[model samples]
Target: MSRFTSICLGFILMMVSCDERDSNPTFSHDIAKIIYHNCSPCHRPNQIGHFNLLTYTDVKTNANKILYTVKNRLMPPWPADPHYTSFVGEKVLTEKEVGLIETWVKQSCPVGDSSQIPALPTFPIGSMLGTPDLHIPVKPIRLQGNYTDRFLVIKVPFEVPRDSFVSMVEFVPGNTKVVHHVNGDLVRFEFDKKKDVYDGSLVDNLVWDSTIRLVYKKIGLLHDDGSYPTLARSVVNYLPGVIAQKYPEGIGGWKVNRKSAFVLADIHYGPTVDDVWDSSYINIFYAKSIPKRPLQEFQLGTLGVSSIVPPLIIAPDKISTYHSSCTITNDISILTINPHMHLLGKSFWAYALTPEHDTIRLIKIPHWDFNWQNFYTFKKMLKIPAGSTIYIEGVFDNTRDNPYNPNNPPKEVHDNNGSMRTTDEMFQFIITYLPYEEGDENISLE
Candidate 1:
């Protein structure tokens, strides 16, 4: 064989190898984009996620775990049944995307040209709603991390002149690991801001009634007694997989008043992390003017859900199914929906029945996961005519099959049980809606 022929043949083999690597997804162009956008949000350091997937080294080291979790629909953690209803904050990967990941991993996870990698998408240190109009900080909530669960209800006050509207509200946790989720109620009271800053201190203060005591309860806000107060209202929420909620333009917002506006955050601590401290803040995005329609939030559930026995209670070593319903008295447009359950929950279904008895499927999670649940905004606003009754049904498994049940021997569980212990269970769903108008069906909270 001629020497020239040998050199040409060797060149051809090297070119083929390079071409195969180029055609496939490289760490720079394909995989990095996917990881940065989808996985890195919670996977970064100091976040709730157990591991970081921020860089090529970080992801490549855990490539197999990533493949298994994403392929099994476990990593991104969106549990809403996509066939029943589509939502706004969905993070599920497409089949094609998942396929690409599998193929890339099978190719021994090759790294391509570094220059092709794009700049990492920036995330705010705390609030996702950029440059909040108001920054109201809550007093540092200290958690000893010794209990199964801890509940802290603190009021962080903000001021308004007359009446205003806010479009976005975000809760930033102090310790993400120790904090499970936070729910806040926006309440207002009559306070002369010109007179005092309401620094949230109770020591050596004369205005105890104006500061610590309950003030102006909003007209629709519900009290513990189940009565609608005139001044306090449900404002915002954060869950394991859920973050901040931003409303659509010119359509939905929460109204605030000058009288005395404060946020009551009902923070629930999940597991104990030694030296846990949770000092969170709420950032508000104020609209220049009132929106076309105001967003209202309602917590709907059944009395049996809170009961320690019968349908509401989970009998030890057995599976239980419970049902709850609420009828709509007025025409409304639903913006979002979120179902809440504890560790032993198995499944959940929520639907609406119109006055004519036409059934509208709202959401269905055949396999309910407590840690991954969030407020799922509808792709478009859902219109339910007046006199429609919405029903929610859930199934709970209290047996040993459920690994998350804290009970070593699987004991009977009750709701709240007058404490935040994990032994209890809860059954409820929250809906964000606005009063239906002529073009209600046309409005989209995308």
Candidate 2:
């Protein structure tokens, strides 16, 4: 063979080998390593996540679902701007890692070798450890197989010799698989007939009626007596993905008077009611000694809006804005901020401007997810100067492209009150902070 021909043939063979290697379906250690590091924290046994992804078979069975969720940036849901600051336990997938999973799924999800699998990551069983100071469980109730929202009120009873304070709290779902989301409220008034309260309350009449089926509905129920609604003077909410937040020093604890009655109800939403959920519980943590600080949550904007036109409509390729503001009177430490919106919400950004016009970016959720929203807690205390103005802006999309749009024809909606309807939208911003003084109370903008 001629020297030139031999050289060209050898080069072509090398090129073919490289292309074959790149296209191969073989799993790399890198792929398994990333999953173990990022997903196993909550996706393991006895955890809040619905499924376990510890083994190769576990990942293979749910391969396509995993890819779709990750590519869409839905699962391991962390809502923060990656460019600004990264959190300690943030769950974001890199481009290369996402591509690797997509390629592996297309290549038949090959399990290269059992021995090559890395050890699953470990996470501490927080708040769940040790016996709870108090546990409140709801009565067992059968969810009717109809499309409706159910509101239930359960009253929890506790006997306190003196005023007590709460430091930490946890809401442990009896059936994490079925409970969509639960909200906790502190009610000082006690009812003699709890069942009647559940049946006749305004919330029950509005949510639990039998008219609508699959579209939207709510159920109302309360907790039982042996378990008192876990009471805390300072901390008002406790749920998974919510962290242990403390107030600034010298703020002191919340006041829970002795012999005072409390009610803790769970607002349960069943997208599709297939199973019967009877026993759900929430645990409350109390400190042996009261701390120098107390946590307080302030509602910055108006609770209801009055608009002549529907405020929340967004047409195809069109943009709409929702604005709300809150004013601060005294210097304080902001522990966390939560932004709430209905299905049409797209993006949210919030900032605080001092009286001098200097601004501080509190938080920004670039892509909003209604299902996984929570109070974004700051790692360190954020001190806001006294007399600051807080501003929030949220954008919504109402066109057909928006999968969450409630309306079909896309009509213009404006009403006197800022209540959400076919054509209207509502806006709200909640901030949790501690007043600078020991006995300083919250001053609301509304």
Candidate 3:
């Protein structure tokens, strides 16, 4: 054949191959696995997802919506920027995968071979950390349909047969819709200090009064002899998309007294229009052995060890940025970090600089979504040198243009002395770590 004729045939073949490739992609073979693995975990029954994405019909119905969100990087809400640093269980889709979904949706969501569709994955029923040694039920809370947020201090009392070492404390929200977040502390009473661990009233409404002593007394947190019991802060926490934080065996576990209680220092439930009841619970997993290196934690900014550089105040109709930093006095292996902000949050970032001037990227959320705050765990332990300085920057948009701004005219907002109210602003970076060990840098947190 002549050179021009040969070139014409090659071009024809290439065009045919491209057409075949576009036509062959289908829902059963191409899209099921992605949704099953990434979206279904939250989109199924009794989850935070608004609707089910479990079947072919469901995908077909929402194909356009799904395509739009993936294109905009909205759905499967992972706030951590993968480019800055990666964490375990990241749900980000690749550019290629996003293109495939786009093409499939554009082609009318073909179901080429229904038989080839992968089976729906099975998820744990109650607890994500497997069977628990003890299950402590949180007292059920009733909420009115007045569209007002409720903050409650609750005590979940329990008595184990004997003092036991616990590796993990898992908080499972019974009402995913209304339950916003939880911060729990462990209260251990001396075996002989109190006759009954269950004698106190279970709950107290924080809105009525927030006086420390009165709240404690109203909730029956004091012992029979009118003395304070041992309290461990941040034993368990819960947010919308957060998986329970479980470290490797013997890394971080706390001992529970025979007579103990799990005090939810404050549990926030979002405003609802319909009256509902929430019955969240806690699961305790016994440790195989005592913790070899107990986990320690500290925070930067807004009532933490470090203070916000320009203070956390945000003026109405304005955008502002604030910074905070803290120097590490001791070498530590950092496990997990949680960046916290409220409705007005725009962006967040954190990093550490060593004395040698080497920069260590910790986490960066270029666009902040208040609904999906998470405790981001590192894939492996991150070692910060003793002289390293960790810095954090947060941006808040209080202008009317900001859709999430709670105020219509965008009134002034600030961290009201580390207030828990959603409308009030807060900038905090909480780090959980352990003193550095010989091979700590090589340890995997997964």
Candidate 4:
């Protein structure tokens, strides 16, 4: 071979190898992909996360924070015990994914060839499912810029022209920073006679220190009485990092009675906010046709506690723990479970015990955060037999050491004389399931 040709070939090989390295672990190719997929959903603006991780600049600026959260198993907060059942939409990074971020940060975030950067995934604007068929909302709530947590309960009337099959429901917040969480319920009732009150009579009856806990009951349950035809079932609910509620494919949507009046569940937005106005609303999606199996949702704690009564009262400067359960009368396919506690929650666990004494691990959150709670859905439906019992237990801390106590000097927390509040505490599991059929277990709830 001629000397010139040999030199050219050698140069070409080195360039090819270097190109491979560029795509190997560079920020544009590797770290960006991981962040966009796992962290971007919550980390982006207009979402719950504090900072944005959309672009290389945003990510590089916050690379150290990201590295710490991922290494400590904090960001992309999913608390379910993976050993039990693999879940859908779980953003928890795998060991490899976590290490990739750590390496990118340790090496100083390098922006490789920007051309290889992938396009951002387009998330739906109005509704995650699609444009909602009906929008039922109360007047937008305005904040006075006090930076105090506020709860508003209003019953807005909606006329359903005919029977509707709801495929999905979503709570889209107007201002996420001011709107911490929202609980939406659907019931067959008329609200024309009810008058909407600001800081209603319920909030008036509470004793607390300068920042002591207030017993704010019925934050959304307008009539304290479970007055609707049936228990107020939640069709739309929101936590900091949770998304829309859509049932599994082929599994039917919950049916709303024909010509019925609906109530909008109240919202929780108090401390850690601005004067921004929030007009959160509920978006209901319709199914193309009725589903084969209808979805059913029920609470398994406080209201539905069957096995043993859990504690609702929290003493001053004390840590409390309790357990609650519900017996499965018939075979059922479990789709999703939501563990709910107010600011004082410490940890949570949920599992099932079959009649044969076999245990089916459902979901467990070792550390509970009121700001980051979400619905945990199984990758595939889990079927529990007719003779099984689902149980949930949670630990509560009202001591001053607990950072989220919400009060300066932790006061005695009780059921507002009889009701519950965000400042007060309660233990329960919200289970979304459908009656099990012969082959229901094979269906996916994703």
The candidate that wins on lDDT is 3
Q: List the residue pairs that clash in candidate 4.
A: 148-270, 149-270, 149-271, 150-269, 150-270
Cα lDDT tens digits, model 3, 400-429, are 989988899789887877555668888999
For 81-188, candidate 1 gives per-residue lDDT tens digits of 777778887888887678778888988888788878778888668676678877877777666757656655555655666667787777777777767777666665
Model 4 per-residue lDDT at 10? 100
Over 4 Å off in model 2, which ranges? 1-29, 41-51, 85-89, 94-113, 116-130, 147-157, 189-253, 259-266, 304-319, 410-425, 436-446
* Model 1 lDDT, full chain set: 0.71
**3 against 4, candidate with superior TM-score:** 3
What Cα-based lDDT does every candidate model obtain? 0.71, 0.58, 0.88, 0.70
**Error at 423, model 3, angstroms:** 2.4
Candidate 4: Cα lDDT at 152? 54
Which runs in model 4 stand beyond 4 Å of their true positions? 1-24, 190-232, 257-264, 270-273, 307-310, 415-418
- Maximum-TM-score candidate: 3
RMSD of each: 8.0, 9.6, 4.3, 6.5
Model 2 scores a TM of 0.70
User: If scored against the real structure, what TM-score would every candidate get?
Assistant: 0.80, 0.70, 0.91, 0.82
Model 2 lDDT-worst window of ten = 208-217
Q: Residue 171 deviation, candidate 4, in Å?
A: 1.9
Ranking by lDDT: 3, 1, 4, 2
